[model samples]
Target: MEVPAERVEPKVEAAYRALGERVSLPGFRKGRVPRALLEQRFRGQVREDVIRALIPESYLEALRETHLEPLGDPRVEEVSFAEGEPLRYRAVVDVKPPLAVKDYSGVPVSRKEVTVTDEEVEALLQQLRERAAEYVPMEGWPALKEDLVILDYQGT
Candidate 1:
């Protein structure tokens, strides 16, 4: 999808100004640097910020213009910026494919019946009792198959 020139320009300028506010120069205090000096000193950083800002706005515009519902994030194809010019980029996106439901209302579904039994409840109670059981040190002859070994585990 193509992004309109008019809409993107103002956003680019705003991004540039915002970037200028955060950038520092040799003589200028924080957020007091001139726009021209900020451009000269931090062209790459400013362009990156402007492109980051422009892409989301441009993508939204592209979606509205084309009337497309995107399925996932768009893949950025290309981005370009030059001094005193608006940032530009191309993006490729996957849109939701057209679909039709056939006999959806008549589709048969089955659910298994479940009932809690006294035996199952007793088994669960037994497990909880085991979890609450205290561990006591026993005279060892190495660990056995059923022994629960409590050890302090440490790792780097």
Candidate 2:
């Protein structure tokens, strides 16, 4: 799909201007810098802005012209620019193929019944007990899992 020549120019310019507003130089305030200064000071930044702006506009135009519905983001292949020239780029987009969708209504779907085992219940109870347990220093012996160590409880 191809973007119209007329629309491409304005979108590129708008992008350029937007980028220019974002770029700052030694002598200019924010959003007040001239395009030439912006171009000189932030060439790479401006080019990126142009790409960001042109791609969307181009994509939209292509979609409208070709009546193609795309699935994902388009892959940009090439982009190039020069002073006074229209921004140009190539993109590969994955478009939805023209096809008849099959009827999905009343399609059978299977669901499994879930059952909790005793072990699972015991594990859950053990976790709750651990959460409620408080650590206490053992006087002479190492602690064991089943040992219910006494603890001083406090709440705020």
- How many clashes in candidate 2? 0
**Pairs that collide, model 1:** none
Tell me the spans in candidate 2 whose CA falls farther than 4 Å from its real position: 1-24, 27-35, 100-156
TM-score of each: 0.54, 0.48
RMSD (Å) per prediction: 7.3, 8.5
Q: Give model 1 RMSD, 1 decimal.
A: 7.3
Per-residue CA lDDT of model 1 for 1-156, tens digit only, reads 444566566765787688777777788888898877766777777667767777887789778987889999999976766645555677888898878877777778899999999999999999999899987788655888877887788999
Q: What is the C-alpha lDDT of each candidate?
A: 0.76, 0.74
Model 2, residue pairs in steric clash: none
The positional error of residue 143 in candidate 1, measured at the CA in angstroms, is 30
lDDT of 2 by residue, 1-156 (tens): 344456556755676688767766788888888877766767777557666766787778778988989899888876766545666778787889889989988899999999999999999999998899986767889768888677689999
Error of 2 at 118 (Å): 31
